[model samples]
Target: MTTALFPPAPVSTWLVPLDDTADGVVASLGLARPEGAPASWLDADERARAARLHDATDRHRWLVSHVALRLLLGAALEVHPSAVSVVREACPRCGGPHGRPALGPSAGRPLRFSLSRSGGHALIALRRGLDVGVDLETATAGTPSPAAPATDGLARWVRTEALLKSTGEGLTRDPDAVALRPTAPGVWSEHVEGDDAAGPELVGPAPTVADLALPSPLVAAVAGPGLDRARVRVHLPATAAA
Candidate 1:
């Protein structure tokens, strides 16, 4: 059967393989550090943040992931690395509320972006004038614990959370207020409303969610306006060894 060709749109997505070193990622994006900016990853509160992450690997991964996101966004915007800023903020635990991450001087522009990382893969979505959110889940083998929630329930919860995050609404409200529906295996979407007092109401069809056919189990979902027609491209970093 012939597959239908997707018409191109302004929305662009890039999936970088985990093998890409932090430096390689920056170089690949053709981004350079702005003059007089500090070369290290640590911000003003690095010491406090380091104390919070007990696992060394987790800490490393977090740092690497943030760096990769900045590099990817920089490349897309053709801006210097130092000109992009990422802030770690909290989200609502129950509903579609997300916190705003710090942005550089260019924040006023119409650029919108989302980032997701799981296992050995990282995904980035970029679009203009649309609220965007992306999520990645690594599949695991074996049965879930009896106390663990059902797959459908988990998917719903995740979808709601992702939508909240996409709109810069973090866990500032009750998570139970949002409702989610699973459209397919490893794919889910939610309709959220009454969450953003000043933002547009999130209504209409959610973006298409799909699982990448990789060796490891991975589930990914994207949500945004006009996502149904937006063209998506996944990029695997060249540094990854096949």
Candidate 2:
């Protein structure tokens, strides 16, 4: 079994291998309602989106997840959290503007990140020069999303999610066309794209994915090209687990 990363002691910064603080990937898992997290940390648009969530818990979790994402990115870039700017790149499939979420022009251009939250828990991950994707699911969460559906189970589901997100072909790509082949324990190194077609990311080798060991009922995974699963680290409060 993999080691659980969530519910770690409340840590300020957990660094991965890097030349400076800005060079390495950072992944964090935390309770959605962190104490004293001000909604003002989010920009006007984020605050408005959070307010649109009908459920109180959903709204709170959305706020915390976005806040955590900005903070992590800001920390890596050595900027204030509020100074971070977010934008979405054009879709890889049709060149539409509603593609994967990305850093704006002023932010680190090569950095790629992904965020997923469920069951009042949030996971955020980012890496410089390499695209990264992450997914988290609670057992109570009924089914995998249709965008990246999995008939097998949770493990395969999250792994596939990381795959699609990393490729930046999200929602537009057909899931049935891509198949994962295992290369190591808890690791997937090969995926087949449909129609003999490849996206911008698919021009490279198949993405590598590793299942994350989270506390019970929470399954997670991260994917990227030539991913060093050991280097991905996450921090959480000690009291986060149910």
Query: Every model's Cα RMSD, please?
Result: 6.8, 8.2
Worst 10 residues of 2 by lDDT: 15-24
Writing each residue's lDDT as its tens digit, candidate 1 over 1-242 gives 00111123555555655555666655444445433433354344543564588887666565666666655555555555556655544443433323555444545566677777775667776666676776665655564413225544544444555566576664554457655555555544554455662333446544434333333455555666545532554444434345
Full-model lDDT for every candidate = 0.53, 0.64
Residue-pair clashes per prediction, in order, are 18, 0
- Tens-place lDDT per residue, model 2, 60-149, is 667767766776666566566677788888977778787989889897456677888766676777777777888887765566544334
Worst 10 residues of 1 by lDDT: 1-10
Give per-model TM-scores: 0.65, 0.75
- The global Cα lDDT (0 to 1) of model 2 is 0.64
Give me candidate 2's TM-score against the actual structure.
0.75
- The C-alpha stretches of model 1 lying farther than 4 A from their native spots are 1-8, 17-20, 26-52, 87-98, 105-108, 143-148, 151-158, 173-177, 181-215, 239-242
Cα RMSD, model 1: 6.8
